[model samples]
Target chain A: SQQGEEDPQALSIQEGENATMNCSYKTSINNLQWYRQNSGRGLVHLILIRSNEREKHSGRLRVTLDTSKKSSSLLITASRAADTASYFCATVDRAGYSTLTFGKGTMLLVSP
Target chain B: EPEVTQTPSHQVTQMGQEVILRCVPISNHLYFYWYRQILGQKVEFLVSFYNNEISEKSEIFDDQFSVERPDGSNFTLKIRSTKLEDSAMYFCASSEALRETQYFGPGTRLLVL
Candidate 1:
């Protein structure tokens, strides 16, 4: 069974627009991490938010976590054509197992 | 910055044939993992290795699947008998700490016929 479930399986927006993707998980987690993958490439870590932390930002990326709702959101500000790719959310269970369970992912298309 | 590397960016093999996918994780990383993504599907965790032992694995990782750190830098995943359904892009990832960010390799796209 999958631990994380991403909403808006597919999204499309023009360049410079803001893109938001949400993920919901089932169990308690130690941390949640967002990753980006270009076609035929490996996943690159974007930002990670620990259970104790509410929000984090890196460059054009903003991540927010709400433990009470067991959900997280990734926002890309002023998106560009280069940002087109599949975005995934992985959750590390609170048990500290160290294994990450990934969601189905949301495919974002940024038009130039 | 150091990144994980995988060999044979693409491989084509016959069903029932054994295949070994290789990966070279970051030199200083302490944990290694293997995950597979079927075409048009989510990334699925296969197994995680740490301290020279299997720390955790998913149901997809059965008796036919095995992992080894043959040397200080190389980590490998071997499948005894490949099935057509096993066709997918296999990714290798490593982390310096237990729950830290994991750096991923380019991935080996395996096609089993």
Candidate 2:
């Protein structure tokens, strides 16, 4: 079963604009994390929101998790051209397993 | 900040051959993991190791796959016999503890012929 599935597979925005990506999961999760990947590069950890947490912030990244809805959203504010990359949402299930089930990801293109 | 490092940034192997992918996780981390991403696909978790043994593994990690923390610093994933379907980007990651933010290493792109 696919756990995290992100919407708007591709997103394009101008520099300084905001980009919002949403992810929905099938089962209960211990935490939901966001990661960024440049083409052919490894995933860079962005932010993590635990099931008990509603929102989290780091630099320009804001992540919100709604366990009741089994959904999450990542908002990158004041987006920069350098932010052009694929953003993925991963979930750690409540089963105590450490594996991360990732989404297909949203490819964000920030234009200058 | 210390980060996970993978050796042999890229490798090409023939079918039925064996290949070993190596990684050096963050020094202070106690948990290590292996994940892979096929071209244009989602990153999938292969296995997770802690305390020198595999704590969890996905269905994708079958008999063809194995993992080892050969030493205090190095963790490795060995594919006994390579398959064309095995070609993908393999990433190593580590975290201080379970459920913590994991730091990922630059992936090793494996191409199986």
lDDT of 1 by residue, A1-112 (tens): 5588998899999999999999999899999999999986899999889999999999999999999999999999999999999999999999868888899899999999
Q: What is the TM-score of chain A alone in each candidate?
A: 0.97, 0.97
Model 2 Cα lDDT, one tens digit per residue, A8-33: 89999999999999999999899999
Q: Each candidate: what lDDT?
A: 0.95, 0.95
Weakest 10 consecutive residues, lDDT, candidate 2 chain B? B49-58
**Tens-digit per-residue lDDT, B31-100, candidate 1:** 9999999999989999999999999999999999999999999999999999999999999999999988
Model 2 ranges off by over 4 Å: none
Instruction: Give the clashing residue pairs of candidate 1, or none.
Output: none
Question: What TM-score, computed on C-alpha atoms, does each candidate reach?
Answer: 0.98, 0.98
Interface RMSD of 2: 0.6
